[model samples]
Target: MKNKQWMSVLLGLTLGGFNFAAEAQTRPNIIFLMTDDQSIHSMGCYGNGDVQTPNLDRLATDGMIFDRHYATTAICMGSRATVMTGLLEYRSGTNFMHGHMQKSTWQKSYPVLLRQAGYRTAFAGKFGFDIQEVPGTKTLPVPSHDFDVWKGGEGQTSYSTKKNESMKEYADEYPHCTLSYGAFGRDFIKESAQTGQPFCLSISFKAPHLPRNADNRFNKLYKDKIFTKPDNFGRENGLHFAKQSHKTRGYNAFEDRDYDKDYNRVIAQYYRQVYGVDVAVGMIRDALKEAGIDQNTVILYTSDNGYFCGAHGFGLKALPYEEASRVPMIIYDPRHSNSGKGLRSATLTGNVDIAPTLLDLAGCSIPEGLDGRSMLSVYEKPTATIHESLPLINVWGVSASHALTVVTKDHKYINWSYAGENYEVTEELYDLNRDSLELVNMAQHPEAKETLKKMQKLYDGHVAHWGQQAVDYNSYQQFGMLFDRTKTWAEKEPFVVELDRASHQSVK
Candidate 1:
């Protein structure tokens, strides 16, 4: 009887070990693909009749698409920082080109947590954050040691040049920087799969951002395509341009040339660059399948921030407009049985939610004090809502004109503050249900007074919750001068200076 009892115990232990191994094998591998300055309106699946994005369209068809995803800050560095740390710009202190993220904040980043949890991680392409080049400092704040593989760029990498260290290997193999990024991503996936561990690969593409350069092969992709101008293309509402100062307008690419000729050529080139990104997407997908990890991988695609293709007479982002703040978000999780393939979700999501959602999906412990909530519930149920409202910020360095916008499902409220020598502020409201394009501002409309008041309350609640305060131009200018490259090291004695105009260019 004692022998039989011992035999039963050994068999039970064996079964438990087998179950544990199976569970470990089933953990989903994650691949996050991010593009630079890509708007939702520029993609084929998002109703762009002119853009040719077959791979992105296929990814949408195989997964879920979000219609109302927004960036907390409509700029590259701020948005990328939000994605990495799961914290808004105000909380993370990584807003604009002003401050580097704190070391304590980097400890709680998703990649760092995932690496500690035994997942093999790789980061390829642009890690869009501004790091000040101090005279004696040997290192910046970038968390390079958190991943098993790290091939990233400092700022906006060139689209056509091989100057970036990360793209040197693939410079000759691929025609454009976008394709080189994809190739590196493919290699990382194959190498990680060989280790037999669940991997998280992040591919951030530096395409269609600035200089609008594309591979020569794609020059004919949109040659015959003549895009229609946006309804608010030419500043039909005089109040819109009134809010922008001359300096802000110059940074926004608002040329005095005719809209027809400029819009067609620039947008066509942008589309061509996007096409190169699409090709790279196809290559990466093929790599996953070739490595036999396709079924167990969750592929997510989004952009750092949206771009303005001549919307409201502006050609770049850094505005509170929908074209700049809203981005394309898609999640393709093949392991999810109830995902309802090709689902369209209108749940309000933002860049801040990416880190927590990824950590939650990876079965890792999400640290406390994260501003973003897990989006896994919304992915499971398409009708769910994550955030009732999100605050949009565009505090570009120490610039005179900055914007704070509160966006909800059906309305948007913007406050443009010129916090310079002369203080001025402008308010604008839009009822999105009636005016999706935001062509009409109802801030002064008598009938919409109650709606405007409600929006104000919501904005106040967000400001209180996030600890946001009015911009202190004096302090901002004093701190900003420390990192100014043009200034000598000895000039670091605290002094207030104008914002570096060269830093506000559109290339970034």
Candidate 2:
């Protein structure tokens, strides 16, 4: 295990060094592959031991992997909005860009800019913002005219055998192609290549998200891999900062009733689902090569948000911890003449950089009023730091109180505010040099006062820049408007141990 990890580290370093040597001779076709509820810790290239991700790892070998990449807000709509717009979610006026898509004020998304720039823009999988007719949200496809090829959001069940079972009516809202959803995105790539037009394709996978219900072929693929539990699993709540809203209940946090076997079972399946996504990535990448456009394509692989797979004993997302906030960012620029090979960058970056970077790559002028800056220059110089300290912000799913955070190379600090005042103030300071697991929260410790103060000041600056707003996460918490009060998988049905055992034995 140590040897494997060392080898991966060496590969990452080699890739990082290659960043500056590459140059783009041509404007590349861009394929942006984003997954739902994926964690950086689950990929082989990102230091996961159990997950098989040859495709993404190959991309890392061929491009760049960002070590400190993250989502500004760790929720579906907000994160996606940030990635698409290269702006803070608060700035977009759609901080909690979920369910109510039609009513949200984000009618003008970043993809619209790409569309105007003469690129064939396409979107697949999940489009953020809840369209469910509710009190606080407006109904029917909240007016976002972004993307030329908008073909995703098949809901929870599509791509699985049960794709038509659970959310049959819901899936009907979006166009359902007979080709597996991944292929649909690749098909767009093929069409774009044929049309001789530059394309921006967002292939969003609803995998490794929930229920761990991947296609049977993928589900049956890695049934025997052992999943090691995270070191910080099953944490006591009071030691950390007090989380806002009811979302941090027993279900989201680690359950005392769960044993090692149950936890591993959930995680192993999640990794397997990721492997399936990786396979799709490989297929698309291979297609790009076959079409002879490999060298002229820029592929970006990332996720919507980080999910805690038994980390901090949490089953759901919505936390500021590294496990739930830090996501994997892989940028494979085949046209980059300097370091076309894998490059590892430790610079502080976020989804907010995505829009500007994409627009910049296409030679399109970035729109004014964007809080994010293009990192194309930094990509050429791997060690060049663009963001000295990046802001990480998130609001509660149940209420309006919001958390403002800033993460630098050395420390992390977060502040919770409610009702236009400091309702609950807590801070965390970690020396990434020593505590990778984040077991020690040194915010209140007198010995770490200076570091905490620095982080606090940075956090304050971010808060002042972004400002306070009645975001959706808070609205869901305080008003329950965006909150989906449905029973969970465990709540809806008892765990059938017999069925799992039978399947396991049969596979063995």
Candidate 3:
């Protein structure tokens, strides 16, 4: 390298040395890939000694791995909505039972903004939520016409490729949805590269999520493999958890999912399903190289949410615990000097930051009043911080599991306000720095009183924000009082009667 080039590289490595406008004529192509219900523990790059994720590991090596990335909402639909709009769940106003995303919000999403900015955009796999013209009006079809290419499906898209209408063409050759997404990515990359226009391809893979139906091609990969259990992985370790959390189905998932009866078999299959996603990642990376656009293209990879995988005796995501909320995040910008240095950042990031990050990379103006900020600084300098704290919300499923929590780098505070009959209002605190596995609840610890009070203040701020800014529709406004610590259980009782009645019976 020449002296001037070396100096330029050094300057680019500074905290705020972003090259936002150097290439006015050509912006890097962005490929955002997300998986469903994949835990950070499932990846080889995340220090899982038992998994095979060479492609993702290599990507981590070539880029920066964010160790503290969290899904603001640890469920599929809510997390996806947060990622799309750079808003928290109450503001996004879209989830399984809440409702559809408003057309106005969808218009301002990252994809629509990028498309409007004259970039080629494509989408494939499960489009988590649909669009509604207005709050409670008739729903519209998935916004396929907004993108240059559309292979996305609605609802829980099938693992069988042929069953998905848009992906049927690749069914014969790929057969399964995981590999079919890879082929779709390859084709999109090749076709986009030919057009000389910057492209953004977002592929949402349905692997490692439900119905286990992983590709049969890799059946022998982990056959009869006895997986190592996490330290906090059973009913005993979960005894310290709040009584309200125990009332939720997540607490009972250990037995329901047979993790207790068939530990080795269940885990092997879980990792096996993740393995298929790894293979598809390899396929897409190879396509990028073959298309000769790998250098100028940026790749952002993460999961919609992390799975419990028997952690804390829980099964799937939606809890505020680390295992269920913090997912793997990697950003690779080949044009930056920071590429290929095997870097890892512990900066606090959340799902809401994804949109702002992508929009910033495209040199598009970030919308005003976003809950997240651009991570370009964090990307330029790994130690740089983007968020002081982020919320981990769970309003889905049984009312007992519903929580409002806030997490800083070293501490997490969760509040379960569902107190009717047998349940009581509960508060749980964890010292993430000392007990990342959540082996102990520090909420009642005498020495931790000061820290607990501080976290409670932060939690209160989030609850206040929910009251002030949450959308008026979809029953979101009710949560303002329900989650308010100042509000007594008597004040909250009337709002939760129906939910309590329905959930109490459903869980049993």
Best by TM-score: 3
- Candidate 3 lDDT, 235-332, residue by residue in tens: 88888888877766777788999988898888888888888888888888899999898998999999999988888888888889999899989999
After superposing candidate 1 on the true structure, give the runs of residues whose Cα lies further than 4 Å from its correct spot. Answer: 1-24, 130-142, 237-242, 245-252, 256-260, 338-340, 419-423, 468-508
Native RMSD of candidate 1 (Å): 6.7
Over 1-508, each residue of candidate 2 has an lDDT whose tens digit, in order, gives 6997676666547655222112223456788888888989889998877678898898898888899887878877778767866767655534442233323334345567666656678876666554433334444652334567666553343653225432233334323322255566567777777766678887777777766565555556667666676677665532464445223542334563353337766777777778778877877887887788888888888988898766655656666678778899888776676455667988888888888888888888887767777777767988888788887766534333345667887777665443222333334577765786777878778999988877777765665554343343322222111111222323312222332333243211
Preferred candidate (lDDT higher): 1 or 2? 1
Provide the RMSD of all predictions against the true structure, rounded to 1 decimal.
6.7, 13.9, 6.3
The TM-score that candidate 1 achieves is 0.85
User: Local distance difference test, per candidate?
Assistant: 0.75, 0.64, 0.88
Model 3 clash count equals: 0
Clashes of each: 0, 33, 0
**Which candidate should be chosen as best, given lDDT against the real structure?**
3
lDDT of 1: 0.75
* Residue pairs clashing, model 1: none
Residue 362 Cα positional deviation in candidate 1, in Å, after optimal superposition: 0.2
Better TM-score candidate (1, 2) = 1
